[model samples]
Target: TELQEIAPKEFEGRIKRQGVVNALDDEDFAAAVRETGRKKLIIAGVTNDVCTVYPTLTALQLGYDVQVVADAGGSPTKMADDIAIRRMENAGATITSTVQLLAELAENWTSERGGKIIPFVMGLMPQQ
Candidate 1:
C-alpha cells in the first residue's frame, strides 16, 4: 500500500510492488529477489534501523549481495543511523553514498548513457 502510494505515476505499470509486514518474516521479498535472477541489491527504506536493517540482514542471510544507500535511508536520530550502518557493514553489506551508487551504475563518464547520467548525478552535488 505505502509502496504503491509513494511510487511515481510514471513507474505504475513497470514496477513490481511487494508488501513486507515484518521484513524479517517477509518471504515474498526473498521470492521477489530470486525471481529477478540477480544476486545484488541496492536498498533504502524509510527508517534505517528497522526498515532498512531488517531487510538487509535477511538478504545477507539468504546469500544475496547487498548495498545500502546511506543518504536515502532515514533514522530517528544520527546515532541510530550510525549504528545501523555499522551493523550492516559488519554483516557484509556495503554501505554507500547515493552519489557513489549512481556513479557505479553509470560505469563511465565518456559513454553515451553517461552523458545523460552524469548531468543528473552532477546536479546532486553540493554547491561550493
Candidate 2:
C-alpha cells in the first residue's frame, strides 16, 4: 500500500483490555506491543485520571518507554486533567504532543514527513 511504503517500520497493533480498578492486568497490553515488534508505546484516551493513566503507568513499570500524547487525551474537566497528569507523572509517564510522535516515528523526510505530512502540519500552523 502507499502508506505502508511511507512508514513500513512504525506499524501499530490494537489490543483489548478489560478489568476494573486494581484488577486490570497489563501483560496482555505488553503482549500486543511486543507482537508489533516495538519497545515504546504511545497512547491516549478519555478519563485520563484512570483508564488512561493506569495502563500507561503499568507499561512504564514493565520497562517500555511510554509517552502519552496529550492532545489525543482529555478529561471531563480541568480538575480531572490536573489529577490525571499528576497521577501519570507519579507513575513515570512522559507527556508529548501528537506532532512529536509523528516526527519520531517518521525519523526523516526521505519518506512521509516531507511527502505526505506537509498538509497536516500546514493545518497546525497559523496562516501567513
Candidate 3:
C-alpha cells in the first residue's frame, strides 16, 4: 500500500492498517487514537463522503475537537463534497484548508516553526 510504503522513518513502528473506510470503525485505529491522549484531531481521508464524514461525526460524538482538512479529501462530485462539508460543520467540526491548517500551526512567520513551514508552503504555491 502507498501509505505503508511512503510512511516516514519516524512512524516506522506505528500501527498502520488497511481495509477500513471509516478509520474509527477499526478497533486498532480507534485504540491507537485513544492511546495518544490527545483531545484535538486533524483528519483528512481520501473520500469526504465516506472516509471523512463518518469519522468526523463519530469523533465529535466522542468529545474530540475535530478539524477536517477540506481540500485534502475529494468526492465524486462537487455537490457531494459540499454536502459532506455542510454535514461536518453542522456536527461541530472545524473545516479548514491545507494552507489554513499550516498557518494555524505555524502561527508566526518569524517563529522557528513558521520559518520552515512558510518556505515549504510557498513551494506548493503556483508561480505567477
TM-score of each: 0.80, 0.66, 0.89
**Model 3 RMSD in angstroms:** 2.1
Runs in model 2 with CA error above 4 Å? 1-30, 107-112, 124-128
Question: Pairs clashing in candidate 3?
Answer: none
lDDT of 3 by residue, 61-122 (tens): 99999999999999999999999999999999999999999999999999999997998689
**Better candidate number, 1 or 2, judged by lDDT:** 1
Taken over the whole model, the C-alpha lDDT of each candidate is: 0.82, 0.70, 0.91
Candidate 2 collision pairs = none
Better of 1 and 2 by TM-score: 1
State the lDDT at 63 in candidate 1: 91
As a whole number from 0 to 100, the lDDT of residue 36 in candidate 3 is: 93
Is candidate 1 or 3 superior in lDDT?
3
- Ten-residue region with minimum lDDT total, candidate 3: 1-10
Candidate 2, residue 26: how far the Cα is off, in Å: 6.6
Candidate 1 total steric clashes: 0
